[model samples]
Target: MNITLVLFLIVVGITLVITGWAARRTRTTVQFWAAGRGIKGWQNGLAIAGDYMSAASFLGIAGLIAFNGYDGFMYSVGWLVAYLTVLFLIAEPMRNTGKYTLADVLSYRMSPIPVRSAAAFSTVAVSASYMMAQMIGAGSLIKILIPSLDTTLKPWFNWTILGTKLDPSITLVGVLMMIYVIAGGMVATTWVQIVKAVMLMGGAILLSFLVLLHFGFNLGGFFNAIAGVKDSKTGLNFTQPGILYTYGKTQVWGVDKALLENVSLGMALILGTAGLPHILMRFFTVPDAKAARQSVAWAMGLIGSFYIMTTFLGFGAATLVGKSNICATVAPKCTPNSNLAAPRLAEYLGNSFFGTGGGEFLLAFIAAVAFATILAVVAGLTLAASGAFSHDFYVNVIRTHLLHGHVSEREQVLVARITAALVGLLSIWLAARVGATANAAALVAGVAFVIASAANLPAILFTLFWKRFNTWGAVASLVGGSLVTIWLVAIGPGWSAPRPGWAPNRSLRRDPVSTRGERPAPLPYIFLVSQRDLVGLIALDVACLLAAAMMLRAWRRRRTRPPLVAAIFVVVLAAVATVLVLLGVTYSLVVGPTFIVALLVIMYTARYERRVTQR
Candidate 1:
């Protein structure tokens, strides 16, 4: 077998062995669902890291940094800090009250049927979005890791799937994820995550150290070198944030609008972590609330270090390896797609550090780690989605309709396994149909996070803190928020950027380069060419509107101008902002929903308290 495939098999084989071991121990429902709460603090922490740090963190960010520079690190900082939200607001409470899944916490006091069904919908939506990113990334990375797959499979494996071209590795992922979760349950999923996490961390640290050692450990020198030269791909300054925020450097309106897009995406990242079903579920894997708390701390350390190291990898590839070479060698999936940066960097380092064979070994190793990263993450997502399906939907909602009594232990386990397999299969089919892009991971993850921030986070927060948050509010938050996010994503720039003649000049990349310099610039790249900003606005507004309505209805149907006023203001403002974005008038996707969500929350809750006391 080829080295890449061999390494891939080794990683999969080891995980499958773990799955067998875990299956034997996974007899009881609790064991199948949460590993019987027997996981140690460190082990669970590593698993969390593994789940959080996917291809997005390892490959996507490094490629982003290699090309986009400072704006790329925003993902790093936002994700690490987001853990604080989880630790303080979510982790302990979730562990304290929750059982198998996050929906348990939502269903704790509310009617289990509607609340859990809504929660299940939100979980599946988020998991599907997140899983899509990893799926497309796994498919695209094969071009570089195993070029033959791209050449041979794309031609002969031309059997179209879901109307998209096929790749063998991409198809294989669906099978692997299904088997891992269905066969082993939480024990297998946790161990897989832990193994991938450890390998990922080791690989990142080693790569970072080698990059530093190449520059004689001089931090200043490394910074100077990165800043001194423009990016080889697009010739932009290497330390600017405009790559994510600016239109082509020449368009004043598009350039300014980029800021709003950045804020919108950042907001999602900051809030989404607390609501991620896979992440929140990890708390139950630990023994107690304290270990759950401790695990976040450990995760923050490891994740922060990994993100920091990614900058070095990005700049290292841009500087030493040359973007031209990477694009040439890993083409149709390099530079702009940027997921190839880490692998290319590893290969470069291997050549620099050892010689010819060195690159082959290093490339094989990194390919395995990245492949393992996708598998472990997909397994976690599948577990969360399927857990919600079985525990919340089947047992809590659907089972009650068909059966007279509670769902049995064996029934729950059987349903969960079946649901997980279905989820894995669906994700593979959906992921296979997706085309490759530079921000594949970011695009998918961003949608999932924004949806969580909009739909799940508010419900979770209100359920925990707002004593008066009723079933209506929780249900509205989940359903209304998810619908809005999904609709916005469907219409947003990300999905709609290719309207035949939107720009007509060719590609619509989001690079921050300008023609003011001696070198000519390419076509104008917009901040939200992928339209994350539009999704953010809709998410924030939906969250506010649903939350406010919940309070208004709960208060004896009393008329309130505040909700109406806020809605009018938001609608008017959103129309104006959307117009500006479409006409290239402004980039203020950041303005419409900024204070509205917070304002609605404070107003509604306070009003509820006053009305209750007076009544």
Candidate 2:
């Protein structure tokens, strides 16, 4: 076998062995879903980091920075800051109340029917969306590493119709993820996540140090290399101040005002973090509320460090290696894809730091790590979705008839495995159809926002401080919020075609029957590419507002509850809404002041939540 293939097989084998060892102890439904509830604070924290940081972090962020400049950091900022909401509000309460999944927390006050049903729906939606993104990323990576494999293996492995080639890599990723998740469950998934997290962070840190050494460990020299490139057309240094602006720079915030844009992106980050099912399920595996709190603290540290390193990696890509090399090695065919930039940078620096042979080896190592990163994350996602399906849907809903009050441990595991396979197939199908669309990131972000705003944030906030939060309110908030978010995203700006003046067809001749035999003047294709981000933001805001209103009206009718609980609910909803609005506005405006204001708002919200809890 080729060395690369052999190396990849070895890595896969090691992961499987470790996963098998972990699965040996998972003999019960509780153990399968929650790792026997004995995981330590720090260990679970690291695993949370692993579960949260998928191919999106390793490949997406750096690629984004390479393409979007400073704006790419917005993703990192949004992702990291989102954790604060989790730390202050969601984690401890979720741990204290829930036994297995998010349904446990939301259904605490009501019938298991609505809560479990909503939990299952939201879990499947978000997990599927997130899994689709990872699958797309994995398919893209495989195409890059072994370009010829697609052609050579296509006839045997892939489906094709009418001369169009269908991608099989998506199916491969989905099947592999299913195997690991079904065989081992959360116990196996958690340990794999921890190991992958360590490898990813270590690989990043090592690459950063090697890049620095390549530049003689001089920060100034690195910037100098970047800033020295002059644009031939403008005679201005490409990397120097005002260079982009001088060339009639397109709006960095892309159609929205700065503040609205920042806030819109921030809303996705802040709320989405709390809503992530895989991350939420991890909290259940811990022993108690205190341990859950500690896990959040550790997750914050690890994630923060990793994000900072990603920023450095982006800089290294831009500085040490020229943009042309990045484009040639990663974004071939002039497609302007940023996802491949980081790996390309690694190859360039690896060759420079080590010999050509060693550099090739290092490149293979990075690829293996990226592959492992995807596998670990997909495993977690599959496990969470499967648990929601088997535990929340089947056992709670369907199999309740057959079990006569209690389902067997073996039955639950079997059902979970079957559900995992179904989910895996759905994700692979979606990824295959979507291919390399520009809206992929936005799609994933929208899912996170929908889940966080609809189910997790409201449920957690009310349960912690509100005494009157009833089953009706929880159901309305969770189900209503999720449905609205999904509807808004479906018709949002990202999916729409641009308005008329944005795109014009230049057909040369104004009149087709001209006697002079001249070409007809171009028809205006204007409005072809104009974005609807502003419209989408407004829609999302209105939907979230409607959700809050439903919850508040329900709370107001409950005369038996403490007045303070109602007051707390109002205060918490207002705080969350304000943060969401600010984030939306900042994203629209794309100004420094807007970002600063949003940050201050987040800080104040954190303080307010703490004070309310203390009272």
Give the number of the best model, judged by lDDT.
1
The alpha-carbon deviation from the true structure for residue 61 of candidate 1, after best TM-score superposition, in angstroms, is: 0.7
lDDT of 2 by residue, 1-615 (tens): 454566667767877897788768777887888988888999999999988888777777876665444556777888888899899888988898888888877777766776788778878877877777787777777777645544555676576444444576666667777777777778888888888888888888888788778778888886676556544545654344332233343333344245555666678778878888888899999998888999999999989888877766776776655455665344436545566667777888778767687667777777778888888988988888888888888998666744547888888877877888888877777777777453564466467666776666787678667998865566666766666666555534444434222112324322222321342332221222124644544454454455445445644654423333434444454455445434432223222222233333333333444445578
Candidate 2 C-alpha error for residue 223, in Å: 4.2
lDDT of 2: 0.70
* Model 2 residue 34 lDDT score: 91
TM-score of 2: 0.75
TM-score of each: 0.80, 0.75
Candidate 1 per-residue C-alpha lDDT over 1-615 given as tens digits, one digit per residue, 9 for 90 to 100: 577777877998999999999999887789888999999888888999999899878887887777777778888888888988988899899999999898899889986776888899999999999888878878777766776645655554566765766656676776788888998999999999999999998898888888999999998998888887574445567776565556443443454556666777778889988888999899998889888888888888888888888888888877777556656345565444466778888988988999998888898899889989989998999999999888888887877754647777888899999998888877877877666553555667788998899999999999999999987689779977887787666545556455432322347443333322432232343343346656755665576566545555544454654545545554555555555554433243344333434444455555556665588
* TM-score, cand. 1 vs. native: 0.80
| Root-mean-square deviation of candidate 1 | 8.2
